[model samples]
Target: MFLGSYFVLSICYNLYLSFFRNSKYYPDPITHLVAKQSEALVDGFGYNAQILPHHAELSMKLIVNQVYLARIIEGCNAISIMILFASFVLSFFGRLKLSLLYILAGLVLIYAMNIIRIAVLAIGIYKFPQHTVFLHSIIFPLIIYGTVFLLWVAWVRIYAKKQNS
Candidate 1:
């Protein structure tokens, strides 16, 4: 069930991304929104960040202090991660309402974490350009994936409660 649901959700998301490629949404809506929100976070951190829409590449350029730190692409928006997280939660197949609510909460947590990750990554890259590789590839990916892992563990433990009862 998890595999099937993950595949279907991934396919649907990919199709949605494909549809927006030629449309007027500007690299689709969610990616753009994520970029904007991340930019706001960076600004809150007082870095003078700017997010410019690159329609041709279908990405947002995350520029901090006039330095190109990263491109906020669709992959950076965390939808795929949410899909994976949601699939696992649903696979457990507990009470319908409980599962749906948990999925929603998990997605929100992931989204917020992604925004903070981007903000911090941009700052890390800005301040410590030498460690870009370690910061981006190693540290930030762990932040999101690690959250999913912990959430999965917590969900499973909750089910243990039900069984114990």
Candidate 2:
């Protein structure tokens, strides 16, 4: 029952985002926000970074030191990841107050991590363009997904245990 509802709600929310959240001026709000935050992070690290919206697609190009380092799309926003995280926590259905607080904290952590990931990827691409394919396609994804997986494991072992006890 929980799984079914989670899937339904997740799919519906994604569909709605696909249709209504995108625009010619920017990617979806979440993706745009991610791109902006990533740019800020990169800049803070003493790199010149800018996020330029793609004219023909739902993506933003991350420009570092006048070179295009990455295209941040909807998938990079971390919203889908958060949805998955929330669904799993909901399925487990721990204490109401604790679960809600955990979800909120987890989402914030994920978002902050994603910004850092994007900034690192941009720097990696800028400094090592030769390895762009491997870095973007493999290592970076593993980092994000691995973090999410660890968060899930921690929740099960820590917060969820409280409910069982």
Candidate 3:
């Protein structure tokens, strides 16, 4: 039941986002916001970072000092990860209030971490162009997925266990 609902809701939400919420200028609002925040953070650190919208609704190029560092898309925004996280938490739901609170906190942490990850990636790519592929394909993913895994572990240990007891 949980998996079914998760898939259905996720598909519906993605479809809605693709058809209604996105535009040619910007694919996804959340992704655009992420890119903007990332650019701001990178610029704050004294780098000339800019987010240029691409033709696709969900594509934006992150340019650092006029050098293209990364292309951020909807997939990079972390919403899908949050949805997956929330789904798992809901599946193993504990006390209603506590579950809701944990989900909110987890989502916030994930979002913040994602933003930081993007900023770091932009900086890393700019400073070490040769390592761009490694940073994007490996390090950044590990950071996000590792955080999610840790969050899941914490949830199981702290909240889910309480339900069993």
Candidate 4:
């Protein structure tokens, strides 16, 4: 009973943090900084750069929360998203205190993944302009979702259901 309540509370807390807190969220601060850095890449790295119009679209739609929440609710976000989701799952299965470790680990992993995604997207746009749409719209989302799916499976096999058994 206590564990169930903790799971509910943790979900609520993650939701609140992602939505209501509205301060800073994982990868947001770093994401913003990276965006700035990316702009200078064209000149600095001599790599042709094109603005990712989706950035504006995502911000305009507040997709950050959407992304985070969707991943949490679905128990998938990409490998990193899965990591974050796992923390919540771990909190429930491993007990709440130990879950904090999962959360921290998830944060680190997510940040790294976010950076890789951004870098790949940027390069994809620069090198294969025509394929940018496919990369951004299809491939990236697929990677994220696919990773999430695998993570959930792993969580079930290794942690969540494992604990229950």
RMSD of 3: 1.9
Q: Which candidate would rank higher by TM-score, 2 or 3?
A: 3
33-150 per-residue lDDT for model 4 (tens digits): 4454443443345554332323322221112211211111112123335444654455446555645565555555554555455556555655676786788778766765565555
| Tens digit of per-residue lDDT, candidate 2, span 29-74 | 7788899999999999999999998777778999999998779988
Report the Cα lDDT for candidate 2: 0.85
Estimate candidate 3's alpha-carbon lDDT, on a 0 to 1 scale.
0.87
C-alpha lDDT (0 to 100) for residue 106 of candidate 4: 53
**Candidate 1 C-alpha error for residue 61, in Å:** 0.5
Candidate 1 residue lDDT tens string, 1-165: 899999999999989988888665568888888999999999999989999987568788999999988898889999999999999987887878888888899999999999999999999999999999999889999999999999999999886787678
The alpha-carbon RMSD values of the candidates against the true structure, listed in the order shown, are 1.2, 1.9, 1.9, 8.5
The Cα local distance difference test for each model comes to 0.91, 0.85, 0.87, 0.47
Q: Report the poorest 10 consecutive residues by lDDT, candidate 2.
A: 20-29
How do the predictions measure up, each by TM-score? 0.95, 0.90, 0.91, 0.51
Comparing 1 and 4 on lDDT, the stronger one: 1
